[model samples]
Target chain A: MRIEANTRRGQPVTIYVDGTPVQAYTGETVAPALLASGRRAWRVTPWGEPRGLFCGIGICFDCTATVNGVPYVRTCQTPVAEGMVIETERPLERDQ
Target chain B: MNPEPVHTDIAVVGAGPAGLSAAVAAAVAGASVTVIDAYSQPGGQYFRQPNPAVDPDPQEPRPRAGRELRHKAEAAGVRFLNRTVVWGAFEDLRLAAYREDTAQAIELQADAIILAPGTYERVAAFPGWTLPGVITTGAAQTLLKEQRLLPGQRIILAGTGPLQLVTAAALVKAGAQVVAVLEGASPGEAILRQPGQTLAAVWGQSTRLKEGWQSWRTLKKAGVPYHRGWGIIAAEGKDSLQAVRIARLDRQWRPIPGTERRLEADTLCLNYGFTPATELAQLFGVQLHWRPAQGGFVPRRDEQMQTNVPGLFIVGDGAGVGGAELAMVEGQIAGLAAARQVLGDSTLTRRIEALQPALRREQRFQQFYARLFTPGPGLDELAAGDTPICRCEGVSKATIVQTIHAGADTMHAVKAVTRCGMGNCQGRVCGPLVAAILAQETGQSPERVGQFRARTPIFPVPLTAFTVLTTEGAESAESRN
Candidate 1:
């Protein structure tokens, strides 16, 4: 099978969630991989609550986090790259 | 911060046959086009399972047919976003979509929008259907189509729909011993629905039928027992499906008391019919009409496939459940029509008109199959008292019956009482079954069943997709509890 390696080919990377830096393989979708890496909660629900990945697919949009300087990247589908800074605790208003 | 919505001349939702054709046609007509779809690859369900060995890669030149058309579209610079889905549409043709890699919403303002979102396999409820081995014919087909894997060695393909026949045939081709196909339609009834359908099945597939007959003549030659008027009363097994109990039905299609028979099988595939992925269309607020010919409610469109919303066209199964050929032809017509609508080209309009006959023939043929393959009345007979009506919520037939008897006349009432349709899948799979039961219980028509309540997040979006602390969460009580 000619595996179409994800957009980011074998590039080692370190992604920091909050202030903790952890090594991760390249081309891994952020959310599940981060959870696999040991982080559990991505954000707090608007009503001063905690919410994790509710819908792994893009439909729920619950796994959003800041990638580098850009906010609102769906961690589940976005592939990781080298030196990518991921911020999970910035309070932002819901789109709805 | 709200990002500025990107503006494009034409935004085609879905990259299946219809959307692709529309995008190509619009682009060929000199309009900037953006084609978005959910799949990581092109080709919707029909062409979805193209074997890597069979399909051409991006580097390779186009396949034998339609090479030039695709090349022209590519040269015309149509932007193909393979893994994007249109969440919904707002007034003034604003399309809300999300990329596959990032669920982050993207907005697009389009002068014209064509929805070719296609259809999904519809599953009705039955006992033990949520068991591991119970899966939709479409799901099994996906396994075969995408991964080239057979579902099982011995399988029973059940339910009423054209998909059952084709899937049984495909599974057999993929080296499976299909024990039998439990068609809900009585033989005479199924054959009778064919003639009024324009003789499409016979004329269109005569060559293939001839081949299939010769190969399986002995199987049919001997009384291998294909119960003409029968339906599955219950699916039973532990951990996985080991067998299904079927019963013969009377003229009114009720299961006879003593005719119940059990068949040994590993996998049970079922499909009542399919419904168009109308989320986007409904979001656009396009007028829709219930067409029994097309399966169920579909967007209202003219012969050219244009919806009431000007510059917005629909094609393929999304328009109605015509097969791939029809989808392609409709795509061509819609593509051409959208092109003309954008360019106001009389020549293109004439060309589109010329293609209408073929498209109509295809639709008529589908109408035949739709009627022939429509779910038989036997479904009411098979939802036995013990059968679990809602697989996701594990609500049983007896519970629903109790709810119905206690004055819960509608599906919504049943849901309000039993919480059957409140699961993540909404009512996509079990809705039709519950509707059938409710209609049967109340002596109401099936149309009334259409009022089943549906919840948001229709698709089974993985919960893992949204979480950041994936490891810690999944590693905790989730595994055991």
Candidate 2:
């Protein structure tokens, strides 16, 4: 069952990783593009855990990455658009 | 602030068959492993009911194999962290997880990670699907396995799949008076149509099904009727499920005249199929194929269970639903493959060959089951105007249909307008039902609606749980260096 395939390859987009600029495709997520681009690590170490994606579905929040300075953007759900810079810093929630 | 850089060679999330197998294999190869899970036990959802203290029926006999596996995992030198909720994963091997009732973070730096998160039940839509007494077959099993509780004494196990029979057998064994096992598919159709696949499956699950069939036969001997060509038409109840109306169907499965029957029961068990729990895989950016066989949108992994992403692997139901034994083999294969990858061993051809037969057998068995229990007729049509498609926010079928007619072409538009999938349960309950409805309304194929668009914040986090973000916060300087 072929659904609508409105996608084409090599459509460039910008993804910021921990505030660093990384080029990506227009219809991909930050984490997979990061790994595909040879960036194995998404964040710095604190506890000795190998984290990437686990439950590819959203039930488990294992794939949450920061996007455009917004914290907890699920990398799996966030598709890339041109010039969309994503941030991957560990967010510290301030008391409101 | 408590800041520390906890480092490890491998961080295995989930303590189920896949996670335990991966952790044990990696640890055997000298990697420090930390296995975390929401449950306080090693077995994720499938191998549930391990702790005998929480036995399904204290008076009834227990299964010996489960007890053995729990013992083996406990002695395998794998660090098991139970009751741990891994809320999110940050880059650099850092994980934001809460444990022991405290919202502290845990950072894991590891060389490799294996994802063995299991699958959850997919409940499709129909009338009274959201009523108090209508629960998933998996949820019923979980209640029995985890807390040793039955929903009611007289229950109607109405749905497709081998689980309908299995759950009936379990309920009967647990002392619930199973009135009838109404399967959506015809029993003898496969014997006439797909004899080859049918025979192969019968051979593989002979022992297991024989046990189930024996229990079912025992229930039948005790006067419990098992109907094959029947489907539920209506679930009648005021505040809960009080009675269920069932009807016999013709070949194409429309209801036959004068065949309608009503049975009094408190609980109705329903499960159309399962969906691959792929949120984390999507997060990791692993490539996914819309595999109806794998329960939809599973990561594209090779025979060795390696995902498209390097050093990141997935197995078990999260990879795709292949039942318990297949998951175990896949887990072992993924563990071995990950270990060999870490060790730089190029000779994995022989290892993969040894694992091929079991995988093939499991796939064949699953294919047989998938063909056997196709959804019953009139279920999707049973959706009344007021029937709730989205249980989380209580969106009705009329609302979704009207929105689609009003120019909501994609699932994204429908979700945005109705807020159906934007609930705490994370659309595990409503997503598939809505997709099917959209497909039916738009004259689109189920596969077309199968590509349901996912928006951000896929998980529903209660607003009260978060204290509004402020700029001032303590730094994790000590943990950083």
Candidate 3:
């Protein structure tokens, strides 16, 4: 979670993750918001194992989630947008 | 939809210390310079910027330095293409990129190219490493540095090198309860054994020593345990990290049998070292030589940082595992050298020659760094049977070992048969891990196993990006969206 009292941040933005609204700021990426909102498993693999932000950078695709109908977008690289719906659980269906 | 390829006298593939400095030098030398970086902003990881809202950090100097470097580049007529992915490098210095915001496919035809692609943290696989809360030391540092966020309430920094102390100190300052910092190698012992060489390596690097001292001071104030000759064996948890199992290690880093201890923590930050980002340079037909201590398979380059391929130069950690200071010096030299070639002017030769001393000093530090921090060979045997090696495909150590034993000895064969490197990450994350697995199983050195053959479109590109360029047509060149 952001150290709200200590740090200055962009304007507040709300994005839905698995149908739950997550509060974020304008300048931050989706990965931080996702982790801050208490969602660690950004994506559930085909084996049903949980994976989160292994490499916060874009190199690892482990943090990919469906963002506003775009499947497999890296949350670590993607910025948080207002009212964006991020679907993580039913990821396989979106890809198909 | 600029159908006409973007033309530039020099094209740089990163915006880190090396690339930024190179861009500034070349542009200042009367050459048109364009740099492309995957990040939304300049200052690749080493000089990674914090949120613009955050005040300049007193402990971290790189972010402020990065801002100045970017400004210097801009003032020198260096154009930056941020948030652009260079997915492919083709013949005759051509590059294919996708602009994220505009959804457009772009191409670059350059006179000369400098690659400062940088390094990615190398992680050794252990049981539960695939858990939700286990992340690399670099990842955690990115979280704290860039986003002003922490991965968990209580974090354990387990890695080799000064990065462990640095990350722990950062975590502590950010209000997280840092449980401990477990250094894989015995650097304290290293300093004691080679005090003279240590002084030589660290002689010119006062700021580095000061930074290490500051981190130690911060950890000491918080009463955080800084364990040398120790490291984590595995991360243990249900869905996320609940604890880390650690143990004492011998000189080779093999965990001692009776020294097992489990420390409760919500997050586990792990790193053995790093791998040079040689994929892009390799795809550009640059020859690679195995330099394990330099983070494996770095591109071969001349003193001027020019690769075997004419007009192509690679610098910084991308060429080898040298730190940011070395990268900047090399960047300047390469920039001056490349600009001299393109503009048909030898006037910049003196400026390039002057940077040799700084470059040599940084090289000395780099060697000292490798000797002190590079973990023992025992790290290669970290993965257990069920431990996942291929993070992209979820391929396990058991499957990989079996594949190697079944005569899939080569890196390519193992990848092909088991789908090890065939995933969204395109083998970047799992390539090193699988190579180690293959080597352990076959009793061959990782160098003998070779690397995964990189192809065009090294990074995954969305299909829709292509349609935008095609639909816009060549006549509507320079369409900004």
Candidate 4:
């Protein structure tokens, strides 16, 4: 759900989330792009509860996802780059 | 493993209004200033600008003003360490900072430190609040302003402060169908009852009055229902938000029975106001006093705005709940004061004195909000037994209540017992709500319940961030560990 700001002069960039390519702009961050791609819940808690974007600010780690092989990075605070790989933290299937 | 740390006359944490002004004032007065901010840009929350690597947002005035302030700071020779976090403040004003992008770690040794970490939205817990698509009022604004994205199609805003109105209007303008705005207080009626104080508060606050009026008019023009004395009692959804249950409130913000109504919405933004991010201050052992309306417990400061910790100053909403204007005034005063402390320049007193009138006006405006929009006492008791109290740890209200009833009534004791504040958020998400609930659950004063104790690396940092940057410690780090 992105309204065309049409204010973007920054070149287009694509970042991959869970192996799916998400189109974004240079100024965009990982979380918004993921939201734009219609993915509401970024993480599935150990209790199998869904959580995403609680505090848009970086303080809350509800938005934590793996970025470029780094685990538990706050997606809201992390900017997007071409070929950037992100994976949302999830409960193990066995646990589920 | 030994290396020379960066030395500066003053290290101002957070580059928002307070930090920017302080950096500029101190630097202009010939103090070597270094500003470390988490955002890539200079604006803190107040003057939040989009990422500067892209085209500037022409639609907003904040970006332009922020650019000018940042330019002034730069011209005054303030060095910026943007996109960096000051995770820990060590002995002797040593700040442990890390840049996530570059994985650069810097131990900044400053003669004086100005803390303007700013405020974050305070979450009042309710049922289904932990569900996805339920976000804070600030989150909605950040999504629109920063990323130019709608958080949801059908949005419902609920909260006490004027930020709810502003966010609602902004959402409407952004083409989102903002269903309704729920204000817990009837401020308009409240104003009529106390005209003189309201008039005094709004007299010199023409800009704010104009802004709030414009937002109100925007909502009215869009035919959005503005419900006064009403607030959201619960968000309804399975995995994500599908709707919200809102209700009219009594004077103490307790929901009136049979007044409950549900609205279908994909997004529910709730804000009770903001709480100062006092982790760093608390980590420094600065004494904090409670002013429930002024963002909970704020650091005790002197006439010069310096805390009991010498050379340490806390200003802006981070210090308390004052708005941007007050932050700038306090920033300017503290900046000059810190500059004077370090540079041994006594001539900055006049400049500091000149900020008084602006400070007074902004403080008066803050008082007005405290009188008008402070959430009713009933808000602190909204979370039911199964309601998630700590969003991060997924700790239920029952767990917290049981822990309290088991003689662990204090915040620290509750945290230690139930692991409420032990998640990645480090209590930022659950601190205020838990503390207030602890106070209520025990019928004790806030002082007796106590705030969370902050530890080193107050913000969660990656072990790799340490290893990737400070390799000296990275190698000896694992070995030493």
Candidate 5:
């Protein structure tokens, strides 16, 4: 569970995670917003092990998720856009 | 057709304190400057500003110094290309970058380039380090500084360096239960080893000393236990971090036989120190020298911050792991020198000369800190055969050992055989560890084992971003013929 540390600024926006509508604040990255909503594991490795936010910066690329149809978008670096869709799981090949 | 490359008097890669300072100084010296950074915003990592759109508390004050320098740079007409990753540095000081917003490839040619790519946190591998809640201390700070988010309810700040103290204080202030702050170096030994130097360093840097004292007091008042000469041997967990195994270390940093203890913590923040992001420097064919004090292999720079390769300058943590203050000073010297080199400005010489004393003082402090927190021999033994050394590839210690035993002697050969350093991170995360392992196996120094040879496209860029560039390449080739 994520703790709210401070009052978030900006208008509340809805971002879809696995097609589920989740509330997110503007100006926040997808990773923190997902974490705040208690969704920590963003991706399963090719080995099928869960991983998330090892390095919060873009360096590690551990927090990558499918955002707006782009797979492997670094959630930590990509700011949340209104109505953005983020998928924790990699879409199947046919979906591409 | 290939678009004409954008030319600038000075191109600064990275917008951190060092890059910002350099850009501002260069622009002020009447050189047209362009600062390119991968982050969406300026300030690099040290002065990371919250995203205004998503920041819940916009009123929270950001690092004023970095912000001020950024503004000054903007006012001085420094062009900033944010969210732009310079993927390759090629012949004639040309740079290829991918702009995130435009989703296009851009080329830049600069008379002089200053690389301040900064550093990334170093992690000594141990069992369960790949767990979800196991993160680097810098990662914790990034969450707190950028999002005001705490890593976990209960956190253990483990590793060496003054950063651990600062991180613990920040965690406590952010309402996280900091279970303990572990330091590999004994405070008494650190001071005793260089009494006169330590005293002089503290005396010379009164402000830093005061800040350190304040952080100490804050941690003490919070009743957080601070353990010196102790380190995390391993983290224990299933899917996420549940606890960390800690042990007291001897002078060589080897764990004491009877000092093993386990503490429950959802989050284990580990950071031995930092490794300089020198891929760009290496790609530019600039010479690198291993100065254990400077973290690892760093680009060799002269007093003016110019590398052995002409027109390529390096500063900040990219040059070496000197902290922000030294980085800023070095940035100024490099900026002024670059501007003078390009613009034939003689007046900038005095300004560069003026910063020497402050630079020397900061260097003295850096040397002291490097000695105090250099990862000890015990850290080398943390990763067992099963421990994952390369997280990106899931290459284990056993795999690396097997590869080495199969006659892969150099880092390059091992990388070729085991794919150790060929990850999304470009080996930034595991290069040092692999080098250390190779050194241990061969009974040679890490420098002799060597670093991975940097190749073009230092960072991964989207294939789609290159479509236009591919056609442009053909056109350019035809035109050249």
Candidate 6:
């Protein structure tokens, strides 16, 4: 559950996560928005372990998720857009 | 398929305080300046401004030092390429950067290049550190400062340096319950024993001293226990962070046998200070020297922030782990020096001369802080054999030790054999840990273990972005055949 820390609000937008509509803000990154919605696990490893948002920066890439059909997009770096589709546990093909 | 190289008088690789200052100074000196940063915003980590859409109090006046520098640089006609990642440094000081918005690779050639990539938080490997709720202090601050998001309901800020206190205060203000602050150094020793040095360090920096005092007062008023000479030995969690095992440390920072205590915490913010981000400098073949006091291997820079390479300059945390204040001073000096070289302007010398005193004072404070917050020896022993040291590859400490025992003497060799530093991070997170492990096992100095040689594409770029280069190479090979 993401706590409301302040009173400032951006234009509320809806982004689909795993085909489920998740509410997000216009200026927030996808990672924080997902965390705010209580979806902490962005990706599941091949070993079935869940990982998400380790560094909170682009460097770690742990927060990577499939966004708008593109796999391994760093959710922390990618800002949320209205109607953006995000998938959490899509397996990255070797060629991709 | 090669992209046309963008030419600039001065190319600043980072938009942090150091890079921003350098770009502004050079632009003010009538030189064409281009500043590039991976972040969409101008401020580096230290001045991470909030995104208006996410920030509840978007109009709240936070620190504007970084914003002011960025604005000044922009006003001086300095070009800023935000959300661009510099992936490689090539011959003649050329840089290859990937633009995130366009997914295109661009080359930049500059008369002079300033590298100020800043630093990354150094985290010691402990059990359960890879858990979901375990994060670096910088990560916590980024969440709070940028997103106004608290890490967890119950958080424990454990680390050394003034950053812990500052982060704890921020977390408290943000309404997170800061259970306690575990500092590795003895507060009395750091404050009382070195009273003269502490006073001298803060002598000219009243604002900084006041900030520190205010943070301390905040924590004190909150009734949060600030344990001195204590450190986290392990974090106990199954899926995410539920608790952390902390212990009292001796002078050498070794944990006392019977002093272990477990604290219930939903989040564990681990920060042992920062390590210089030297991938670009290392890629450029700039010389690096190990200065343990300055937080490990850093690029060697002269007084003017110029590296051994004539046109290559490094400042900020990229050169060393000096804070933003020193980074600004160094950046100004470097910018002035670079401008003098490229524009043949000697008038900038007076400005550079004027910054020397402030630079010296900041340096003095940095040295004192470094000495006071040196990571304890016990931190080296925190990673058990099964603990994951390289989070990128999920390589365990045992695997690294096994690789070492199997005759992989150097870090490069170990990486080659175990793929410890070959993950998405490209050794940024595991490089220091592996080096420390190698040093401990082989009895070789960290310098002797050596850092991983950074290859082209320092940051991971999309494979599709490289299709043009690959096609060109294929075409050339077909023509030769």
lDDT of 2 at A36: 47
lDDT of 6: 0.83
- Candidate 5: where is the Cα deviation over 4 Å? A1-6, A90-96, B54-62, B467-481
Interface RMSD of each: 10.8, 21.0, 1.6, 1.5, 2.2, 2.0
TM-score of each: 0.72, 0.75, 0.95, 0.95, 0.95, 0.94
Identify the runs in model 6 with alpha carbons over 4 angstroms from their true place: A1-5, A90-96, B54-62, B467-481
DockQ of each: 0.04, 0.02, 0.73, 0.77, 0.59, 0.58
Point out the higher-scoring one by lDDT: 2 or 6: 6
Model 5: share of native contacts present? 0.62
- Ranked by lDDT, the better of candidates 4 and 6 is 4
Candidate 1 residues B305-419, lDDT tens each? 8887777788889788887678888887887777777767778977787887777667666766675566656555555576666644567889998999999998889998998
Predicted candidate 4 versus true structure: per-residue lDDT over B1-481, tens digit per residue: 2256789999999999998999999999999999999987778777888765665644578777888899999999999998898887666777778886777777788999999999878878888889899998888888888788899989998888889998899889888999999899988887899899988887788888889999999999999999999988888888899999988899999999999999999999989888888888877778899887788889999867899889999998999888888898999999999999999998888888888888888889888888888887889788889998887788998898889999996788899999999988888889888988888878999877778888766777765444323323322111221
Q: What docking tier does model 4 reach?
A: medium
Query: What TM-score number comes out for model 3?
Result: 0.95
Write candidate 2's Cα lDDT for B300-419 as tens digits: 998788877777788887888777777778877877777677766656547757978877888788777676666643566667888777754668899999999999978888988998
Question: For candidate 1, what is the DockQ?
Answer: 0.04
Backbone-clash count (model 6): 1
Report how far residue A10 has shifted in candidate 2, in Å: 61
Off by over 4 Å in 4: A93-96, B57-59, B464-481
Model 5: per-residue lDDT, tens digit, B1-481? 2467889999999999899999999999999999999987799988888655554234433466667788899999999999999887767787888998779788888999999999989888888888888888888888887777887878999888888998899788778899999998876776987799888776578767776787798899999999998999998877788889999998888999998999999888989999898888877777889888998888878899998878889999888998998999999999999999999989889999999998998898898888888878778888989988888888999999999988999999999999888988878888888998999988888889888877767788987555434333332211121
Output DockQ, candidate 5.
Answer: 0.59
Task: For each candidate in the order shown, give its overall lDDT on alpha carbons.
Answer: 0.64, 0.64, 0.86, 0.85, 0.84, 0.83
lDDT by residue (A1-96, candidate 6, tens digit) is 344645465789999998999998777889888888876577876544568888887888788888999878999899898999998863454323
